[model samples]
Target: MAGGIFVVPLLTLFAGASFPTAVAVSLVSVIACSCASAPQFLSARLVNLRLAAVLELATVAGSVVGVLLVGSIAPGILYGLFAVVLLVSAAQMLRPRRSAQPLGSGWGERLRLASSAPDAGGVDQRYHVGSLPIGLSLMFGAGTLSALLGIGSGVLKIPAMDAALRLPLKVSSATANLMIGVTATGTAAAYLILGKVDLVLAGPVVLGSVLGAVLGARAMVRVNGSVLRVAFVLVLAALAVPMGLTAFGIEIGPLR
Candidate 1:
């Protein structure tokens, strides 16, 4: 999440890296962050493998389309798009969540996407997954954004899983952490082939991202779900400032 969401803007605005170079670094760092945090989330039984598999189908396809559009789109437009995405995600997170109670006869039962995770009190909280089609559509959009902006799509995925699928916030977060690595792999390869990867810059970012991911993952399980939701919205809104201004060609001097 840091790599994809925070790294790119920091690199582009603060470090004076080109957008493409920053994006490439972001993609690689996303893999590192996801890989680092995935095992912890899995062990905690937070990831939904079945839902991930189904949603990923749409995501990967959208990513491919995003990769193809990269060369044709202008930098200003890309920046604007990124800003729009961040703002939209923030707004969605700030909204009241839908009831997560099971629908009893929807995609959850048909595809067996429902599962349980331990709550803060260590109770196994069973949750139902619904609206497979809506979730899939949002995931496809998320995948496209991931490839185009190199933010791992977690920003979008979490909200989509909540608003569309009625998944718990922790479940959405953990499952998204699991899915981003796979979503970024092909996009990263495409960037690499286009000679966008700056190994010298990516090396340090990847290392920092991995270390941060480990710490963040450890802290996540202890955080209250309501607090976490508020934090997500705040972070998204904060990051949107520099990116939004950048869309209009204003430089905020390194966001560091």
Candidate 2:
């Protein structure tokens, strides 16, 4: 569930990257992470392509807006925004989510977004997509945040998937990973064209992301869904502290 957002905090805390630059570099890693993990997720049947396709439209549009606005947002405000996103995501994950919509509701049925995922015991647990409008709105915000913060928006996407769309955690995680690459691509390209991406710093991040994604994909199927949710919450909450502090002009690491 950490997905590519993992790289952002690492870059900021240890690599001396400013939040904006860290976000830009993290965009590259997000793509690498998504691509590297796709085969495993697809084969496992955990990805919801129909749901992803509909959601990507909003995410992609928001990313364009984010790229346009990235230059104007202040660093302090970026830090505060990151903190709020992290805290909110962590809180959201703590509560279990399920699709309240009936299968016969035909909401997601029409979109073909209702699906199933294997439980820890290897049984298929069926679910339906709900609140697509809410999901799309959140996804639009997530995409803009992805471009501005460089966390692949997985930080928000998974929650949007689980809470608004009512997908199982495993499915939400996998689908978010699947969509993350596409979401990051547009913003990453814009940053690269604008000379905002630091190739020197990004190379190692990409390598690590690829390796980490491979390992994570292999481990995901075996892990419990509840464990996965808690794991992400902890990491996100931990990162929020440092980001919040930096917003207040305190520093725990070197700043660019």
Candidate 3:
């Protein structure tokens, strides 16, 4: 969870060597994180194919625009916006949920983008379409931030799905994982064409992340995650502070 929160900001400070370097690292993280989580999600039948597709289309479209804008945008300005985003995400994670309210109508009845899926527990849970316009709008923000910062927008997406759209936590997290890879793929191609990718530098980070994520996911199967949520929230809070400070030019060490 700390890795999820801090990796991008640390890299943004220490890296930014080239647009390609950052994008490459983001891709490695997205691929590794998504792949690691894929099986359990698949086995648990937690993914909503229809909803994922809709968001993917929007995300990929947004990525194109966002990545193109990166060359012209100023880093400090971008990071300032990013810090706000991180702060917002951290706040969401820290907020408590009222699970008792019936999650409301299933996806079919609620929003146009929602879909039903079986949870990790193998119980069929209906999820509503939830604020489709709002969710898509959030995806646009996620895409923009991702392109500017070279980080997966899952941090943004997961929370919106949970709070505004009312998707179960597990489903939102899994779907965010599904979306990250595709979003990265869109920007990565542009970075590659621009001659920004440095495979040598990217190799070790990708390798380490992939292996670690796989191990982490496997362990997730055996562990009880009830308490991990609080830990994850704290991790989010910790990462937000440094990134926010650095973005605003409040100097923080280059710990990347």
Candidate 1 regions exceeding 4 Å error are 223-235, 252-256
Please identify model 2 stretches exceeding 4 Å from their true place. 99-101, 104-107, 116-126, 223-234, 253-256
**What's the lDDT for all of these models?**
0.84, 0.80, 0.66
Cα shift from native, residue 41, model 3 (Å): 1.2
- Compose the digit string of candidate 1's lDDT tens values, residues 74-152: 9988888888878887777667776556564376688888889888778998898867888888899888988889888
lDDT of 1: 0.84
lDDT of 2 by residue, 1-256 (tens): 4354567767777777777788878889889989999999898888889888999999999999988888798888888888887887788777656646444335577787888888768898887887788889989988898888887776577667766777777788888888888888998887899898999998988898899989978886677978787878888898889888988888884543
Better of 1 and 3 by lDDT: 1
Highest lDDT scorer: 1
Write candidate 3's Cα lDDT for 134-207 as tens digits. 77878877777676666777666875677556777767767777777777777767666766767776677676
Q: Return the clash pairs for model 2, or none.
A: none
Report the error of model 3 at residue 177, Å: 1.0
Pairs that collide in candidate 1 are 4-151, 14-254
Instruction: State TM-scores per candidate.
Output: 0.90, 0.87, 0.81
**Candidate 3 deviant stretches above 4 angstroms:** 1-5, 13-20, 98-115, 119-121, 221-227, 253-256
TM-score of 3: 0.81
